[model samples]
Structure formats: structure tokens, C-alpha cells
Target: MPRVTFPHVAESYRSFKMLMEDLGNEVILPPRPSKHTLDLGVRYAPEFACFPVKILLGTYLETCPKGVELIVTSGGVGPCRAGHYAQLHKKILHSLGYPVDIVVFEPPRLYPLDFLHNIQRLNPRRMSYRAIYECIRRAWRKLQALDNVEKLTHKVRPRETIRGATTRTYRRVLEWIDRAYSLVEIEEAERSALEELQKVPQDPNRDVLRVGIVGEVYVLLEPASNLEIEEALGNLGVEVERSLFLTGWTRDNTWAETTEGLTVKEAAMPYLPELLGGHGRDSIGNTVLYAKRGFDGVIQLAPFTCIPEIVARTILPRVSEEHNIPVLTFFLDEQTGKAGMTTRLEAFVDLMRRKKAARRPA
Candidate 1:
């Protein structure tokens, strides 16, 4: 049996980890990324690697000393560096003498059988098809539960009168959902979470500004690497909408079907007409969709040296000018400072407020 560990990019990852655990593997989750993790990644990662790759390297390094036998990670292949990330990570680990097995979950797009084969490695109970399907269903349920709670958090954070009230409630909600097993339990946890969140005193007329966050999945999902941008915006009294959700993304990729996101895809056609891979077009599409929905502003988060977002960044100003909405772009790296980022966020919120006021009838 393989003793496995993986990077914890977001709390939703807990859902995925639960999947691996239920599959009969001993899974070790690396600690949340911190200064120490960044330092380790920076020291070992090649110069000019994007912020995510370095932090991910740091994530694996932290797990190595714990005697993990396998480092399992999702894999991809395309026009972006992500296609090569797993191999690079494996090579780097071997170079450092870790010599651990790194299982990359190849998408069914490339080799139809690869996905099943990879999962079969964890099949201690005869690898029945029904068993594998059930494991995935449970994992999907957990992820969906987390996503629903997060959506509610986004809505409540801006209106909650008490500082950090929604954040505190959201943490508890996660634990509640994590403890749930069946679909009914998951639905119950979500309903209870929303009810609990509603108890927080909220100012219905607080002149809150709504902003949509769009960018690469790595930066979009990894709060630690992105400096907890969503929470920061919420605490600053801005309602934040994220462009990506793991449940939606998984269904789109695995099932080869577009969910409600297809409308966003169609909306983006006027600006970004091509599927540029690495979610470059989706970033463009999401911004356009939010702008049409009368959002106050949009924030584009990208990793330093990230090619896809770099492509998206060049076009955002055009979208902003056309839609009459402000756009702020942040390029995160090892040197990103909380103080500077906070200052920028404060200024952006102020601008949105003044602009909203100006638009009111005299």
C-alpha cells in the first residue's frame, strides 16, 4: 500500500483528500502553505517558475520528511506549463534524492484508460467498477457541499455587521459539511450552514460593492499563495465572486459537458473567441459576464510569469473601458507583500464606492 500526500490548495481539497482516504489509501495532507513552504520552494524550484509551481514544490518538500511514499497529483497536458508540471516536480524530487513515486492522474482525454488505471492502484478491495464510481460520487458530494457553503459566504461576508462573523461561521460550516457522509447529510449541512450564516447581523443598506475575481486556477484557488485575496476583499466590505469552482470544472472536464458555465463561454466570444487553454478564455468570458451583470469592478489575479493570465491581462483594460467598470490586476510571486496588497485593495474599494455614488441620481 502506498502512503500518499498532496498539496492542500484550498479547503475544497479536504473533499478530495476524503476521497483518497475512502479509497483505502493512507493520505497525508501537507500543512497549509506558509513562509517556510515558500522558502523551501524558492530554494529548490528553477528560477522564473511561476509562483504556484514554487509553492507546490514547497508543499511536496514539507511532506517528504514525514516519510510519505507517494506524491499523487492531478496532471494535465496542453499549451501551458501545467502539462509539464508533474514531470518537472517528479524530476526535481528525484534530483533531491527523495525518490518517491509521483502518480499523475492523467485525464481521460489523453488516454481513456489512464484514469482508471491510476485509480486501480488504490483498489485494495478487488477494484470493482461500482466501488470506484461510489468513491468518486462521495468525493463529488463533499466538494459540492463546500462550494455551496462558500457561495453563501461570499454573499454574507459583505453584509455581515460584525467583523469576521461570516468567516467564523464559514469555518464551522466546513467542519459540519466534512462530518457529513451521505447526500442527505450533505444537503442538511448546507441548509444548516446557510441558516447559521443568516443569524449574523447584516446591514441591508450598507452600500456594498461587488467585484468578480478571475484568473488561473492555481492562483484563483490557492488562498495562501494569493495572500487570501477573497477574505481580504470581504473584510474590506466588498462582495467577491470567484470565477472557478472545482465541482463545475471537474464536471466540465471529466464529463465533457458544459454546465451553466456555457453561457459565460458564449458571452466571452465577443472578446476572446478562442479556447486558449489554461482557462485564459474563461477569464475573459467571466469578466465580460460579470460586467454585463452590473458588477462594480473586477480583479484579475495571476501568478508572476504566468502566460495565460498575461494574455488575459492585456485585454482586460479594453473590457473595462467598454463596460465602464474598473479592473485591478495583481501579479503574485514570492515577493508579494501584504502591506502593499492591502493598500491597493483599500484604494480599489474606495474608488468603487465613489464611482457608485457618482452614478446615483442627483
Candidate 2:
């Protein structure tokens, strides 16, 4: 099978890769987020599509040869637009003249048994409980560690150098994290990445503006969609913080599910029932958490039609007002541009700088 994988946030890739390898199929990794990717995605995708979805669809077009047999990816189900992504992508790909199997890995929540059965079909070499257990453990640990390191880097001195180093190191580790078959190797990789990142010398004179990014997972993590938000911030001498990174999500939320009785106070359950679905519950908790962290400001990046973020959007103003933090909400669709986003981010950074200066002890 001429298989390919869409790039996602760093931490999720390990578990994704381990599962794929277990299934006895190799996936061609599309290049990481760069100008090249953004251009390709923008050139080929439909006008009204979500940014990340466009990039993913474009990635398949760019990578797959004319005779390729199949493309596979995880898809969601429900009122959320995510559930329809696979079908939309498939239709779009077919219209673009690539009529092949768009094998979707549907959400297990809606079809647990069917999900398992599909996995079994894909990789008949059933994973032993011990093996599955080990992989999950490693993936979680590395993710949490990476999250902690990133958060600390943002608050530290010489923000750009530290942020850049840590990011590069984490990316390197992520690409290789799946190859580890033991806990020790995972631990070693985590330690080595952090140590290398920390060794990047800090500059004393650079004034770093710290800004927080929040919102739907796709727009936040996928660079093709966000126009390299982090890099744009860093270029403007600001340290960018994102609430949707996999490590932070895994640490603040997923840990409770996997480690029974080991709850983290940072992410409390929202009073509102999860109304938007998918990651709705987490967004509620995260909105409150980001407010408490005293970040300069928060930027929410949801797809134009993303319902969960719309719901979160209603709640976030209350969180921001109560905490007195400025919040910028961006609804991104296919038309979002690098220049437009850059201008907005530059303005936000200037606002943060003025706010910080106002409080300086003179």
C-alpha cells in the first residue's frame, strides 16, 4: 500500500506511529510544517474548508503518486465538523482525480468494538497487553515531560533562543520516539532532549513578550493553518505559548483517565456539560487554567465553523474578564493568510509590550 501520514503536533505522533507500525504498514510522513507546506495546501484546497483540513488534503495530493492505492487517517463523528472531514477530504481528493480508498479510522467513542475490529483487521499481529501498556506509558511520559519543558522555556530569559532550541530538540525526539522498545530508552530520549534544549545560552538584553494561544486543536498545532504562529511570534521577539500542545493536554487531562486516582488540580472539570463534543470539556477547563497563569494574553484559533470553540468562545470572555486578561479570538477558514495573521500578531505583541511597560518599576 502506498500509505502516507499527515503531520500533527509532536507528542501525538509517537502513539500514532506505534499503532501504525503495529498494524504492519509504513506511512510516508509529509514534511513538517513550513512555507512549502502552507503554499501547497493553500494552492490546492477549497475556499471554505478549515485550514488544517486543507493542509492535510493538500499533503495527500502533494505526496501521493497518480497510482497510489489508499490514504488513511483518524476521523471524528457527531455534530462536530471533524466527523465529516474524511468524507470531505475523500470527495475533494476524488474530484482532484485521485479516486482511491480513503480509509478512515473512526472515533472509538462511537464505535468501540468496530474500532477494535478495524484495528485487528489492519494489524492481525495482535498487540500483547504488556506491549500496549509499555507503548502508552512511554508516549504519555515523554509528552508530559515535553510539555513541562516548553512551559518553563516560555517563562525563562532569552525567550527566542530557548524557545527555538527546545522546539528543535522536541521535534527531533518526536520523530524518533516510536523506535524505543523500552521505558529506559524513552526516559533517556526525554532527558537528552531537555538537556540539549536547556544548554542553549540565553541573551540578557532581549525583551521577550509572552503570549498564550488557545482554541481548536487543529488550528493551534498545524502550522499550515496558523501560518507558523510560533515562528511569527518569535520573529517579533515574543515567546508564544499554546494551550493545545499534546504534552500539556496529556499531562493536564489524559493523565487522570489513564492513571486512576491520580487527578491533577490544574484542569478541573467544567460545570457545563460537554456541549460541543470532541474536546469541548477540555477547552472549558483549559480556558480557566490559562487565565490563572497570568499569560500576557490569549489567542483562540478555531476553524470558522468549529462548534466547540464557539461554545468555548462564549465562556472565555467570562474567564478573561474575571482574570483581567486580554483575549483575541481568530476564526480561521481556507482564506486565512500569512500576511493578515502576521499583522494581527504584531499588533497583539505591541499591546503586550505596552502593558508590561506600564507595570514596570521605574
Give lDDT tens digits, candidate 2, residues 1-362: 33545445534555565555555556665555555655766776666666677667666766565354556677764467777777887777787777756667775688888776665544535676576556557657756655665554554423545446645654565544445545687677666656665666666578776666777777776665666676667667767666667544644443434324323233434435544565555565655555555567878888876777777788777767776777787888755676888788878888888888998998
Question: lDDT, candidate 2, residue 32?
Answer: 56
TM-scores across all candidates? 0.93, 0.75
Task: Identify the candidate with maximal lDDT.
Answer: 1
Model 2's TM-score against the true structure: 0.75
Regions more than 4 Å wrong, model 2: 1-15, 33-46, 66-70, 94-99, 106-110, 124-181, 203-209, 235-237, 247-274, 278-285, 310-319, 360-362
Clashing pairs in 1: none
Off by over 4 Å in 1: 249-262
Q: How would you encode candidate 1's per-residue C-alpha lDDT over 132-168 as one tens digit per residue?
A: 7887888888888788788778888889889999989
lDDT, candidates in the order shown: 0.83, 0.63
Candidate 2 vs. truth: CA RMSD? 5.0
